[model samples]
Target: MQDSESLQIARAMRRIPRWWLIPVVVLVVLAGLGAAYWAGTSTTAGTESTPPLAAVVPVSATVERRAVVKQVVLSGKVVAGAESVLQASHAEGVDRLVVTAVAKEAGSHVAPGDLLAVVSGRPLLILPAGVPLYRDITQGEAGPDVESLQTVLTSWGYACPVTGSFDLPTQQALGFWYKAAGFKAPTASDPISQGEAGSAAPKPSSSDIMFRWREFVQVPGDTGKVASIAGSGAILADDGVVARIRVADDAIVARADVVQAEQFAVGMRVTVRAGSTALDTTVAKVSSFLEGEHSENTIPGKDITVALPPGAQGFAAGQSVTVTAGSAATESLAVPLIAIRQEGGRPYLLVQANDQKNDQANGQPRRLEVKITAQADGWAAIADVDGLLVGDEVTLQ
Candidate 1:
């Protein structure tokens, strides 16, 4: 009976289907693959999520001595003022007033006793401010006009009496003037004989010279620059204008907007530019014009007038120019604006603390409090109780 039971158990085991064994084998293989996938995913996640430590470096600049100034650039044009007119006056024994020769042209500088032009064979001369030459001055004339002539002669180092009389000394001085001016002196009138018998020649009169009214023209100013003059051979009526002289220096006139005008004031120093040339000048006047007051086609604004320095050159009327005006330049210890940091409404800088300037790694940067005295062109002029010296390195970030 035990043998029969053992045989029956063997047959039962053999009778079990091989397909059920295949499914168990497949499940074991799938579990192994799932474990491997989970392990790879966790390892990859841990490697990707971790970050490495890094050392940060900052940008830096060196402190330097610099000038800080805030300026406004404006477009302007040159203007001339106080123009004097030279006129052609009627002369004795001359029919037509014709410009015979032009000695000085436009843009020439002139002084007292300078020849302007020639009118009908008579010289036109510039004289100092004096009495109007209404009549001819001959010998023995006594008046304010004669005194004025004497005064001019005295100024020219001539020995003439300022006694309001065209005496011997006056005629002698006039002769000197005529010779120096490259002209011949006018002949005096003939003297009368006493009685045609043993008569002396009346002491031969002091000099044989007289002054004609039309030769000398008085200028309104001491010195001037010619603006315009009549061409040679031009004809004119009595008392016609011959030349225009500028008694005042050139001025820069510019219109500024309301904001820019507010920053401008009289006596401010300025720089005027014409092409490659530049001149230093000062603000002469500042005025405001209401809407439609200054011109019909212009906007309301402030007119800035700048006076060119005495003897300024290379500028002409109506020529375009550039004007730069602002606060005076302040020179101090300065640094780049990027190096400044603000904290709690106070400005500070990160200065390198290392005594060895090149050894940046030896010491940590120090925070320094500073007062910004001025700022311009990306530079800040600073002042501090603990002074920051020039050539010191400062971190920008």
Candidate 2:
């Protein structure tokens, strides 16, 4: 009955109502359905929203056993050592650079005082290398160093201000005297009034400085220490040729096993190589360790080393190079890299002094000073391990 009634109504409306009325009713019904669909989708909004995953951080182990060193250290540097400083009698002009020369490259040899390079100035010859120098006029005593220089200058007519002291004017006077005498200009070897000496002569312009250079031949050889003012201007050498002209660059020039002064020490860790075999070298010079310079970019490291290679082939004085020092030894304590601290200009190491409290049964925690034998990467060095017993409970700091 209801269906029949609805059908009748629909027919009646279709027959009586206008087209606009039916269209309006249908549009309103569609809007209502759309609103209901939106409400259903929006219900689970809280459960749908979730952020993305984040990154993870790695954790590192705080303790590990250090490796035991057993290999024979094939001690060697990648480059040759600095060439020896060509020392002359503090003379100003006799080819001041004669003693320097390209004796040989990384693997060559040469005699003493051989012609390495030509320098400007007179060659003075009173002292040999490694002589401690302090300036004084004693060599010419009553013959004051100043008056002697002034007399030489005045005679040459430079009218050097007689300061009664060997100052710049005096040096200039000396230079003038030398040039006027048709010899290379000279510098003082400490400004002493020497009795019978002046440079021989200067060569004509085109002549190489080598022509005016005084010759110094290599005798047998005593591995003696050589020293001079601390600068090797330009003039680099591999085998005697100035491969690099780095002027005014300072470098160290050391002879075999030589250090300045009477201070001698036993360096244990060193580099020793024989062709292909790398030997763990023994050091004898504690001072051999380089104390790097101070600067913004400086990584200061101390050298506890023995002397440079003894008779290492192809090394020269004043060669710029670096090396990996050998292992060092302390009396008996093998102090681990951890447990060492630096404070107030001293190094402190933790020792297992009390056996009762020690977990490792060596000893309990106590502080002791262990003579440093050598250091690498991260570890405390000791020459002997007697005092540091096995299983000594050294804390891993």
Candidate 3:
């Protein structure tokens, strides 16, 4: 009976089926493959999801010493500093006058005592500045006109006292002047003979004096250039302008608008440009008020005189020019204009700290407050600020 039971157990184990065993083995292989694939995918996903470290970009600039200039440029014209308009006048009892000949044309250079033109068939001469000659200065004259004549005579190499009264010495000087001017000398009559009864005194005529009334236009200073002249056939009216002259000794003047004039000051240096040449000059004078009339919307300008240095010639009146006026230079610690930043209407700069041990306090760039005093050529002159020094490395952005 035990042998029969053992044989039956063996038969049952064999009958469990080889097909079922094969299915179990395949399921086991699939589970292992799934576990291995899941493990590999999880490792890759973890590596890809990790965060990266930030990158460090270095940007810096060096502080340097630079010159800062503040300047204003203006447009103007080159004009004569002193100009005079000559008018026609005549002595008492003279009715009409006519221009006969024009000896000096327009743009003619003239000096004291030079002949300008011929009026009423007589030479019209240029004389030194003096009181207007209303009548011929004679030996018996006693007035300021006499003193002026004496001064002119002395200036012309003839020595004579400038006393208001024309004395004997004046008469002698006048005689000498007449001889030098190619005129006949005057003869004096005896005073004692004239005082006696039955003696007729001879009166001096216009031709007897060294100067005549209204025959010359007195020019101020040493030399002048004629700007304009009336035609030779023009009639001489009492108050008609005959010619215009520009004095040579005066400086070159430029008129600036009120806004521009406010920036000008006496003795300020200026650069004047004419064509291809440039001249350095100084401000000689500034007018207190506007000089011309303007429309309601326009503002007139004031006159500004510039002192031309010696040999600064080659400029004409009415020629267009450019003027550059600059303020005093300021030299101090400076930086690039781009380095400065504004926040809340205040200027600030970023400076790199030198101490690396205090990384928590100064790891990043330090902020510094700065004031800009002047600016020029993409650079700014800065006031002294804490933690800012020359040669310090600064962050621009």
Best candidate, lDDT: 1
lDDT of 2 by residue, 139-243 (tens): 122234456445544654776676665555555554444444334532233222222224333322211111112222121231222222222353323332222
Any runs in candidate 2 off by more than 4 Å, and if so which?
Answer: 1-19, 22-26, 35-63, 67-307, 313-397
Q: Could you give candidate 3's per-residue lDDT for residues 216-256 as a string of tens digits?
A: 67777747788788788889767756778877534666667
lDDT, residue 248, model 1: 83
Best by TM-score: 1
lDDT of 1 by residue, 57-77 (tens): 777899998888778888889
Q: In candidate 1, which residue pairs clash? A: none
Taking all chains together, each candidate's TM-score versus the true structure is: 0.55, 0.25, 0.54
Q: How far in Å is the alpha carbon of 178 misplaced in model 1? A: 1.8
Runs with alpha carbons beyond 4 Å of true place in candidate 3: 1-61, 64-66, 78-109, 115-121, 185-211, 220-222, 228-243, 248-263, 273-279, 291-302, 307-321, 327-333, 336-391, 394-397
Give me the displacement of residue 141 in model 1, in angstroms. Answer: 4.4
Q: Candidate order by lDDT, highest to lowest?
A: 1, 3, 2
User: What is the TM-score ranking, best to worst?
Assistant: 1, 3, 2
